[model samples]
Target: MTPTDTRALVAIDLGAESCRVSLLRWLPTGPQCTLVHRFLNNAVETENGLRWKIDAIEAGLMEGLHRCAAIATEGVRSIAVDGWAVDYARLDDDGKAMEDPYCYRDVRNITSEESVHAIIPAAQMRVLTAIGIMRINTLYQLYADKLAGRPQAPWLNLPEYILERLGGRRVSEYTNATHTQLIDMHTGTWATGIFERLELDPEMAAPLVLPGSIVGKVTGELATLPAFADTQLVAPCCHDTASAIAGIPDAADDWAYISSGTWSLVGTLLQEAINTQPAREENLTNFGGAGGRILFHKNVNGMWLLRGCLDVWRAAGKDWSFDELLPLAEAQHTPHHLLDVDDPDLLLPGDMPNRINRQLLERGFGEISTKPEDAPAMTALILHSLAARYAQVLGAIADITGKKLKKLYIVGGGSRNALLNRLTAQATGLEVVVGASESSTLGNFAVQMAAVESSADAETIAEWAGVLRTAF
Candidate 1:
């Protein structure tokens, strides 16, 4: 596994709205990438609550792997999985998933959020973990399970659980683990003090491993697939944002990144975590980034607003592709109601248009129409609101981290939105550079390659990322 190694690597990026399986096939000329498979991924509403379709996701992944094996006639070197953070799966003693992992958007966390905060206030928790106290964080979900008298067993983030299921060792990757609000930012381990105060068994947490650790070789029935045979299972930035940041092709500290998709993570990378009172009050989170960097950012509600609205529109027989809808939004020049995208009411499922209007009315603003013809206005509103929020968060990060921002890197599916990129640049007054649309997947593959090359150190990861990302 040297730079000259020609073996292919597979990267599975599990996203909130969709999941993708991509392959980097090394060739004599250069590495070539193929999107082996992609499938729509959505949390289904169940009798218990809204939950991820974990079984369906697993099946889809296997199908994708078989396809990759067929294409990569060259032997596959390794594989890795990166995904959204916080929501996790609880496993029993026998390594059985007790139930489907709850979607972070599920309403069940509302009650538990209060109880958990009563024990350890959000501000104080921020001081401990240096992570924003989101209601959907894994800590609140685990607290809910504890209150319901559920058995205490090993609980792993969704990606970690999937890796374990695939014969990789069960361990929490550091980047994703930081999102749980249970890890101490200073020590990079479970906050024993917080867990004790909340009566949680800290042992339930899997051992913390940094990104690029080789979990193990692929195992179980899936290993029988040609692509998985002898394939090492590696952990990239298990949190998609971390992976996306790692996939940045350039190296510089003056630029910020917005891992824009269902959620917009706006921040810059720092070597040290920020836990100042101002940072806590602003709800900024300091996540572990690749290359010994700290992801200092805010989690702003993103495309979920427009995505929910689009669902309502399509159900009403007003169907249009996202491409077609964007131009319509860009063409509409009328001033519209602005929304505080982070409002909790807008965080749930169903009738998003109405919820937005209600918020607008409460704010003494005119209500926008939900009709299909009004899609342009709605889309514009959502995009503008998001850009504004990004700017606000960027300003806060700059103030707190004392980093003078020079450029903004917009990555992920949302990077394709030309209008949003322009608006982001205008709102933040920083040049917005957009590319690496599949950054998380690229980072996933880069990390695997680093592990294979046995140069998985942070500096090597950053260097290898630039070379690997060329496949895109």
Candidate 2:
């Protein structure tokens, strides 16, 4: 423990498919992190659409925090949270959430998105915000809400929504806010003009805060947790991708960040948005980032293809594990065909392999196999295709931004896949550093440390980040 006894922070990270709560503590043994709890998270589809079950997730985190409180002799100094971007909740005037927010994978926005393109034109939005042309963006999601008739819900982005209900403050973090596509590229604030265009109530949107800001503290029954009542709640690059990028140890100019998870977020950090014509054509995004940087990245269809294939295979009784599939595919040699992971059809959930096969057939690749042996080969091909796509997208990001990124850092769950990693290194032709798979947790702790110190600036945060490079 530290000389004063309080030697750590808590960071809670939520994802589309899972959630984790960990305690980062320092001791004579040096720094260590204990994962107090983790749970699977899947959007529960409702009459409205696919949405997160926040109550269940919060319950899991509470149980985890309680466990951490039991283990630590002294209370942690602070806590922070980060989660998947683009999904959020509506709050009532009293600050209670109206309902669980829609999942980014929901389909209703498909219709409204075309209208979004018509308003600003997809090309124009790309030039203005450097965001990709996706129907599931916050802009399209909010537009879908206005069409549904319930207009004036309280403004709370996902992490803020959860933190607020736990007695923490209600506000949006800029890194996550940029994912909303409603934030101005240059000003780094909500684009009032875009909201006006969508007829969205500006009041319903929360104010944008930055990473390392202390919003509030957990309250209500949660406040009763031993050693946690006095802990401050910090906003730490609240978007999982943003946090993952922040976790990268290097501060050099020519580095790229590949926050590999369910999705492969391949991009680099920039001082400002790359809102250029070529960037627009490439559908490259300039999302708000940690340390006041921009995350210029693209979402590549990632391990989802393989996972989805396994899911279907398991239902059919094959029950193959990823470990098993890796070797099987590695040994087999088969002629390959590829499908664009970003195809609109693949965006919505269902039989992913079937969708992939169907798309391949439409593109004249012919039908694929249902045999177990084929799963591995197909999965490898999928990974290779993803690597190729990453290279393609990064090339454009480099062209549009005029930045020469020579190194790539891969983090999150998918980074554990060595096969994909080697292929990515080969495809990008850059020196690759395998980062701690739990980058969000590191980033969460980083921001908490910075928030506790009022004088901490971007440079200071970057310096302290060396602590993370060692923690792993």
Candidate 3:
């Protein structure tokens, strides 16, 4: 590839609900972005359990890359990948997949958490990994596998798996690996102690690499594409939320971020890990982030709650679109039932409307209607509940971190919901700054540019990020 400062960069962002491949091309005026391709992503239900359609994802990604190559006549400098964390692909000795990866929502971990807690106890685990205890965490999933007599195979998280498929070395990105609850928060490395306690093979894990590190270059058939020739594969905060946080143009201390998507990760950046008793009790997590910062956040249930109700409606032959629902929701003014969005029951896939009502009744609140005509009320309820949770989490973050959070930045696809944004601002009483809807992709591009133009070191990448603010 030609040595040019202004070549295009491709960002592949994998989400639990959907995935998109974005092309960031430097133009004469500034940087321009094209969402080259996008598609709905879901876990396939099977006789055994829920599994990610990895083959379908691979096909979609190939088509997207072809489209990027067609449009990027000037050639692409490098590519990066980021995605949702925790779930991983198990590979055999020959580096072949054992089966389609299990979805994080699979119920196999329900009984697994108790077993894990028995081994290390929740309090000690939190102090060890500095991760919030959750059934969806990889540690529980792996323990579930062990309980089921599944074969011990090497594993790689989704983004890292994609990198390995792209001729990059097998390695886990720091930001995403923390979500697995397998990394030691203090050493910033794999927690070998946990591995020993659980009787898991430490060799199954790939070595940890920090965000912005160039893992490898485009090789095989992909390298033959004109746009991909000599393209380097950089890991940009491989966790999608981390990438979204990295994309925020401003780096002021007083502003916090909400990486709003299927899940709302609300928190601020920190320089060190917080493993105090209060943080553990509040279920706050401290994960590595871009620029050598720590992401101290809480995972609040987000759009998935509404999407669940939408699924129930569609399955009942009463389909409705967001455009149809949002306006109606905005038109309604009556008080609706509020929910604890993080209720464990709502985390599962099916019968969301019934689940919401069940939760309401259990909490001594009146149930709301889920009929197509009552979509407005149900939508309103979800939004109000989420906004309230955002406010609550923001307050806790301030108390725990002792940071005076003055501004809240809502970045990611959920930022487009004006109704929720208004509620978030009002509820939190903080200056709300709405950022680009494609924050994760933009952050991926920024890191790729830094890796190509200068170095991927945290300090250098952060300096380049400041200079490239106008480009976004």
Tell me how many clashing residue pairs each candidate has.
Answer: 0, 1, 0
- Please write out the lDDT profile of model 2 over residues 58-138, one tens digit for every residue: 788888888888877577677788998888887777876577778888888887797777778876676666677777788
Off by over 4 Å in 2: 1-5, 454-456
Every model's TM-score: 0.97, 0.95, 0.96
Give each model's whole-structure lDDT. 0.87, 0.78, 0.87
lDDT tens digits, residue span 1-472, model 3: 1225677888999998888998888777667788889998999899889999998998899999999999998888888999999999998766656789999999899989999999999999999999989889999999999999997789999999998888789999999999999999988989999999999898999999888888999988989988888788888889999888887767568988898989999999998989899999999999888878899999999889888888888878888888888888988884555788999998888888889899989989888887767878888888988999999999999999999999999999999998899989989999999987888887777677767776665565555555455455
How well does candidate 2 match the true structure in TM-score terms?
Answer: 0.95
Off by over 4 Å in 1: 334-336
Superposed Cα deviation of residue 326, candidate 3 (Å): 2.0
